[model samples]
Target: MAKKETVWRGLIAACGLFLILLTVSIGVFLCYKGLGTFTLYKHSVWEFLFSSNWNPADDFQGGGQVGAAIFIVGSVSICLLALLIATPFSLAAAIFMAVISPRVSNRLLQPAVEIFVGIPSVVYGWVGLTVLVPLIQKIFNLQYGYSVLAGGIVLAVMIFPTITSVSADSIRNIPLQYQEAAYGLGSTRWQVIRRVLVPAARPGILTGVILGLARAFGEALAVAMVIGKMKAFPTGILSPTNNLTAAIASDMGGAADGGEYNIALWTMALLLLVISFAFILIVRKISSKGVRER
Candidate 1:
């Protein structure tokens, strides 16, 4: 028994160490490759981060003007919009599934949602391209439908299952005694949910939201298809734009190995890594606050 226990513990420890090592390795690699762009091209990090001009044409063969401000803004806008669209629906679904309609949730709704998760991103993109894009254009009387709005809508659908699943799990984990206490205090079901359940599950819900945001930020294929891939600052939600992930996907292949363009792509990847880390930190902070409140 001791030997088996020791083996299992070692295996778990090894897995944890491997994950840590992998994360550190990726961060180091991105920093090295990303910083190389500034050194090789003599471009200021400030310009790369703040400037909207992303003209890699001149730098195709060598170092040229490369700025990612527009892509960064577009990425932020799309993610914000997606969260706005998804959060309310996801929360409602979670509440219904965990509190109001467990039988239906288990028998039908969860399976339906799982099906959505199983569908390929490319299929979602294609549907957006063929259906949502044209509908948006026609309704809004725009020349093109491929815009930030389209991307946000598509991304909302993609992250819906993630947010809903996590939130449902969080709500379901709430102690039954909490609900009974609320009822004893003359609280109704809705009131109990609003005051007791939601507050208790807040940390987990926030974690789910952040995870969904990460998915929205990192998504490449689906957003790329509907966002028009324009290398400019988004003037409005209706405007066509590009994102960091899309820019990397579309431009990386054309860049020669060890070239300025390649390095610029690496820099975008580094920015993505930074954004992901920030989200993780935010999750930790929320978790800590929840513990303190308890």
Candidate 2:
């Protein structure tokens, strides 16, 4: 029995190590492939990262036209919009769940949230296209059903569950002794949550928001379905926009293998990765500060 248990533990450890190595290998491989495109184009990496016009047709030989500024702006705008919509709702819902009533939280609200999170982004996209687009078009009389506003709305729905779940967990983790101390000091429930609970959970909340942003950045199918996918810069929330993920999804198939167009798509992917890593780093810093203060 002892020998069998030891073998099982060894297998579990080996499997975990293998999974970590595999994940790192995949990241390195993608980074290398995406970075190779810039070198092939013969332009400085800075130019590729910052330029505004992305005319792959002008760079058949991989010479120029490597720009991502407009795409970056749209992505940032859409994510900001989603975050603006999701953060308050998620935080409030989390607070309600954590402090108000566990019966309501554990029975009804939590399951509802889990269900929302499980709903496919594609399904949300379809609903946005069919229901939201028509409503917006009727109200605003836009030329297109697909717009950045629609996309942002869809993204908000997708991100809500992520933010709420993480925020709830963070709030739940706050020490009960802290709550006792606050109550001992004659603090009201609202006062304790607004002051003590939220501050203590600030790092986790930020981390959740960052993770939600990352998720929104990588979402392609849903955004592609609602966003007009136009190459032009967005004029407003109602304007058609093409984010980095959408651009790649829209153009990848038509792009010739080893061609400038394909290379440009790869470059866009690398930019997305950089943005994601930056958010992760920021979250880690906030978490570190929270720990130091604690």
Candidate 3:
């Protein structure tokens, strides 16, 4: 029995180590391929990062200016806007589920949220394309509704379930003693929720927000359907633009292997990987803080 347990533990440890090694290998591969755009092509990192003039389709080797500021701005704007639009509604739903009315939540709301999570991203994009796009165009009087606003709205809906579920779980995890104490102190239900429950669950809520943002940043096809794939910086929220993931998805196939364009797309992929790492670090920090508080 002892030997069997030792073997089972070793097998699990091996699987964990394999995953770590696989992750490291992928990172190294991306770094090697991504850095070629600057290192091999003689392109300066500053121009690649800060400049907005991205004309990489010269059908040649070293190629055109590879500025990525436009994509970066588009990604940031749409994701932040999505978070801004989604958070309040998601939080309200979470509070209703976890605090205001738990019975109805388990029966109706929770399953609905889980179904939303299971819905394909393409379905969201399709709905946005057919329904939201025309509505936005009619309301805003634009030539087309493929803009940052459209992408943000679509992304917001896609991430709603994630934020709602995480926040609900966080609130539900709060100790019963806290609520009892709040009520004992003559606090109303609303007051207890606002001053006690929300404060206690803030870190977990933040983790969910960051996770949603990370997903928004990585989403490509759904965003591409609504984001117009414009290679320029958006003048406003309603203006058309493109993001890193969309650009990579659209251009990577046509770009020649080892060419400046290909490597630049790879560089954009590396940037995304970096963003994911940052979010993970932030989540870990928040989780540690939450644990210490507990």
Q: Which candidate number has the best lDDT?
A: 3
How do the residues 57-107 of candidate 1 rate in per-residue lDDT, one tens digit apiece?
Answer: 435355577888999999999999999999999999999999999999999
Clash-forming residue pairs, model 1: none
The count of residue-pair clashes in candidate 2 stands at 0
In order, how many clashes per candidate? 0, 0, 0
Q: Comparing candidate 1 with candidate 2, which one achieves the higher TM-score?
A: 1
Put the candidates in lDDT order, highest first.
3, 1, 2
Question: What is residue 3's positional error in candidate 3, in angstroms?
Answer: 2.5
Evaluate model 1: give its lDDT: 0.91
lDDT score at residue 45, model 1, on the 0-100 scale: 84
lDDT string, candidate 3, 227-268, tens digits: 899888899999999999999998899888887788889989
